[model samples]
Target chain A: MPHLPPLLAKPVDIAPLWLVERVARMIFSCVLKAHPDLFARLGDYRESRYCFSPSDLQLHFRVVPATQALSVSRGTPPPADAHIEGPIALLLGLLEGRCDADALFFSRDLSVSGDMEAMLALRNTLDDSAIDLPRVIGSFGGPFSPVVTGFARYIRTRVLEGRETAWN
Target chain B: MELICPAGTPAAFREALEAGADAVYCGFRDETNARNFPGLNFSREELRQSIALARRKNVQTFVALNTFMRAGDEALWYSAADDAVALGADALILADFGLMAYVAERYPQQRLHVSVQASASNPDAIRFLVETFNAKRVVLPRVLTVQDIARLTSQIDCEVEIFVFGGLCVMAEGRCSLSSYATGKSPNMNGVCSPASHVRYREEGGSLVSELGAYTINRFGSGEASGYPTLCKGRFDVAGAEGYTFEDPVSLDVIDEIDALRAAGVSALKIEGRQRGRAYVAEVVSVLKKALGATSAERAPLVSRLRTLSEGQRTTSGAYDKRWR
Candidate 1:
């Protein structure tokens, strides 16, 4: 392996897994609210457990979607129906269509395992339902919403700049 | 000129055909093709069906057996070519010299195309493939200017295809080893570069960092758009200057250069996203189809729309414009 810069050798925590899950649940809930048919389009796999593992963060989330409700918990479920694992930046890019899902998967930057149909459905649904994380988080006008949005923006900027600078 | 598009799956194949693609190119679900992503590509049955569908619509189906063959795994690539031919592929796009020779000898009647993965940029290299393998067309690598293409077209005997849109590889095709150096997988042999299995992202000091293998490709700031962590597109510090040292994380959009390409005696316009989804295939093909027939005045808005679909919201003509060199 090539030498990584000394500044990037150590992992830093901008937010904990629990905080990320909590914010993810809130953001997904808002996404569901805006696009009511989003989860419905998931068909029979609406209740399936999906695992998202951010390799660098050493964190994983088991996401479950019930009718009109979405839950994200830290760590994997006992038996996940599908797993989408990648860098958090690429995962977020998948949501916003900023990153090419195929490019990530082709370059081996993203991996999907288990339920192929469910994964495809999830991918198509995400592609169809436009998701803007900052906009959604910022829309939650409450005492803590600004803090959430600020943190989200901070993370977004760092990841994006990292991605942009890494190559171009 | 023909509009050749990429289709990673059956649905995307159908989408491209429906969206006015003159031909659709794809690969089998394995490492035989360059865009070897998991959960993508077509199975044998799917390819058969897709070809039938394309035939029904009067659109050609080209099978990409473009990945280089390992010495011991020669049969695998030969089998891929046999299967592609048996499945009624209109043409076989190939890269390996041995595989090309094998296909040329085995299926003498099958139409053969030189893949961009061959990196036959100059007239001499391209002429060698055309004369040796009887390749009918050659997909030019994204390293030549429109003028360079025009010059090569005048010198080469076979048809020339150039990438018009989608992801851009900064390095020369078939020669880049950055991904293999960072990750064990080789795009030539394994049909993947910067494989997803080797990528990781971490947050350090409020900055988000993307790593491919053990190398830190880039670090991002707050609210910035993140691009994919391909080795070629990553930002790096060269002599203390922090920026993309090789190339930017930008997509190649040559919609505005259609006339230049057409004038250059180009045979076809190729879209580069086979690993993309059906919606992307439909959207991009639909726009390019319109652009093909629209006037310059009518194309400005369409070009802007394409920019929205580019990587990191950025697009370039790449080496198509001489200024980039």
Candidate 2:
């Protein structure tokens, strides 16, 4: 197996799964609150916003760090401002800056629902931010390399286990 | 009374027909069909030719258009239905409700057989399909026992086709997302499960590790035989347990149970594995055709002869006996 980068090594149990997801959401909300220009391209003056949907076992965060966000589920789709719905691997690929939003959208991995401009704003915002998972691990005094590596390992393990997504 | 066999390709179709299959079931080469492998299934022209050939042999051809339709891409499925009807298919096997509705509404003259992908386990669901869409036959999922099959036959108006031999899916059909979760492609969405596109085999430290996508599904030493990587049958570790957690690698061989199945009112005996070669089709078909005629006492010896050809050299009655559950 190849080595996983430090960014993906964070352990799931560092906090509750819900808290970990909520923390990621809070980070995005704070980033949007601090820098409105970051999201300007993603939204218009009338439709500047962020959308988040947390299922019982999965958390989805689509933010317009600059303008608009859209969300969709299996049967229901939210208004398309910034759209993203995917298994954890694809979602992680988008959030970790490892994948381009355009590739995911074109490949039909992550679907878009609302205004393309607003969706782009949210995608760009999420793509540009450096979430600094290692720093978060260090503050908690956990093994940074091992955690990120473990998370990546878990992804690889569960993928083999035939679990598909990172949700229940 | 009909022996419907699966044909992954034209060669398999020929093999099944020559082996005395009364009817052969196959799919198109595209995503409209379920066995969406590279060299498997018939093209439109090939299907047209195969239908004519089967007709000469007095064997019917059923086209499997079993995949679920995506939100924006109902056109592909719609066109497939039109093509199947135009090409003179004996029947159209379908699972999707919207697509079933489309076929029912668009080509009412064409016969409809319900694919096991719908997971319609109950009599009510079967009756609904029969009453609403006029399904002529239904391939029941492997989750039901012989008693269940008998009960279902007593209740439903349509004919039932039971899988008698070939690969056994331990998981309930259409309900599993293990393949889609590992690889982005899915049987429900893309008409394939554990597709070869994402499979990788590597020799490491004198042992072979088989991977699906990026995850290792199986590892075997030089002495061990490697099996195909199906999620439900794959060995895994969960809660400090390691081994075949769901099901051991095996095939479903009910060669000896043909009499029981006949007694239970099974209209057709199906052999799975459209991905298999023509030789496999011929061998399995010949054995099954003979077994279909043999008495219960005579079948034991024939079933024993078929043991070596079975996957992993082991077979299960597989939900036919409720104790296996």
Q: What DockQ results do all the predictions give, each relative to the true complex?
A: 0.06, 0.01
Most accurate candidate by lDDT: 1
Candidate 1: segments with Cα more than 4 A from true spot: A1-49, A52-168, B204-206
> Tens digits of per-residue lDDT for model 1 on A37-81?
665446567777787776655456676766444444444444677
lDDT of 2 by residue, B1-325 (tens): 6788888756568778898999999998778876776545677987998999999999999999999988898999999899999999999999998999998998888999999888888999999999899898999999888888988898888899988888787666777898999999888888888886676655578565667887888776654545566777777888888888777767888777777788889999988877655545666788778888888888778767444445555678888876833
lDDT of 1 by residue, B164-235 (tens): 999898678988898999998878888988776676765567565778888999876654546667888889
TM-score of chain A of each: 0.70, 0.48
Q: After superposition, how far is residue B215 of candidate 2 from its true place, in Å?
A: 1.8
Give the proportion of true interface contacts each model preserves, from 0 to 1: 0.04, 0.00
**lDDT (0-100) at residue A32 of candidate 2?**
46
Q: Name the 10 consecutive residues with the lowest summed lDDT in model 1 chain B.
A: B219-228
Error of 2 at A148 (Å): 66
